[model samples]
Target: MANKTYSFYPGCSSQNKASSSNYLVSTNSMCQKLGITLNEVPDWNCCGASIGYGGGGELPRIVLSARNLALSEQHNAGQDMVATCAACWLASREAKERLDHSPQMKADANEALKEAGLEYKGQAQARHMVEVLIEDIGYDALKAGVKKPLQGVKFAGYVGCQTNRPFGIAGESFENPLYLDNLVEAMGGEAVKSYDQKVTCCGGALAFSEPEKSQKQIKDIIESAYDHGADMIVTPCPLCQANVEIYQGEVNKRYGTKFNIPVTYYSQLITVAYGGTAAEAGLNGHVVAPAKLAEIAGK
Candidate 1:
């Protein structure tokens, strides 16, 4: 496959040493194997994430996403804007949709961009990295690139909320998106086809403000994975990965249940399958170690 370049938007969560830093590491390894180049949008700011529209209001959120789009248009002209974070991609894509449909919103966002000497012409399309992987690269190519296939590992493809609802990857069912499952199969991993909690909400920012409520949701997600006999839970959303993986201890304490399933990003799985080591795939970053992936990576 020919190499492709994109204007990358590494959101706050994926920054170095941040919650999802491992995601960036694994993504870099996966993209390198796939011959994809990610040119980060210079001077990019937050996309306001999932709650931007509610907390910051419409115009401010739009302006924030527009600034990043403007920067990408100027610095990485003619390239699509790609974000690995589900919230960043959703927020930015929603902003772009709003700006494109509403003239007043576009005018207001462009007006705000003037302060930073950047103007958004809406030239670039915002896309999630998973979309690029499945839609642009194709599953056959991904399967062909696998050097060490995950032959026996069972993965529950968790889709979470943001990436599935409102706007989802084209040609996928929002209720039961199978792209992650398909990607797992492409990497020679066993996808839990009957995994029912794939599109369940991981509580997003609610995981902080309302731990009890959010943990309930997370408990359901993890418990379902265990019920399905999944070796690990894989997702495309950083927030989903963090919430589900990090809060298991708390959930166990609260619910008196043992839950220690490894939650990983789809990229990490692909990276390991592409012959990357445990360190290269960022397996050490997991709070609960993915022994299966580590074992696979070691082979």
Candidate 2:
């Protein structure tokens, strides 16, 4: 396969030492195996996430992502802007849509961009990394790159809220997106097709503001995965992975239910399946380590 490249927009969570830094590491390993190059958009800023709307107001929130689009268009012209973080993709895509549809919003955003010595042409298309993996690089090509097939492993594909609702990956059902399931199967792992709560919200920023209510939602997500006999949970969203994996212990303590399921990104799974080591796959960064993947990589 010929090498493919895109302007990468790794959001705040995936930055160095950030909560989802491991996600970025595993993504690099996965792309290397797939022969993809991620040229980061120069001087990219935060996507403002979903929470940005409330705090920063409508225009500021839109401008935040518009700035990123402007930078990507300026630096990596013609390449699509890809983000691993679901929130980043959502926020950026939402900004582009708003600017393109509304002339006033576009004018206002461009005015703000002038302050940064930049302007929004609205040419860059924002996409989640999973879309690039599934759409740009098909499942057949993904399966062909597997050097270590995940034979006995079973994964519960968790799509979460942001990536599923409003504007999801093209050609996928919003309610039950099977792209994650297909990716798991492509990697030689069993996809828990029966696993429900795949589109359940992990409470996003609410997890920090309202722990009690959010933990309950997290409980349901992890519980469903276990009920489906999944060995681990896989997700495309960095927030979902962190919220689901990091909160298991707390959820267990609060609910008096022992839950220790390893939550991972699809990139990490692909990295392991592509013959990358545990470190390369960033498996060691897990709060609940995916011992199965570590064992596979060690072999």
**What lDDT tens digits, residue by residue, belong to model 1 across residues 182-291?**
99999999999989999999899989989999999999999889899899999999999999999999999999999988999999999999999999899999999999
Worst-scoring 10-residue span by lDDT in model 1: 49-58
Clashes of 2: 0
TM-score of 2: 0.99
Q: lDDT of all predictions, in order shown? A: 0.93, 0.93
Tens digit per residue, CA lDDT, model 2, 165-257: 899989999998999999999999999999999999999999999999999999999999999999999999999999999988899899999
TM-score of 1: 0.98
The backbone clash count of each candidate, in order, is 0, 0
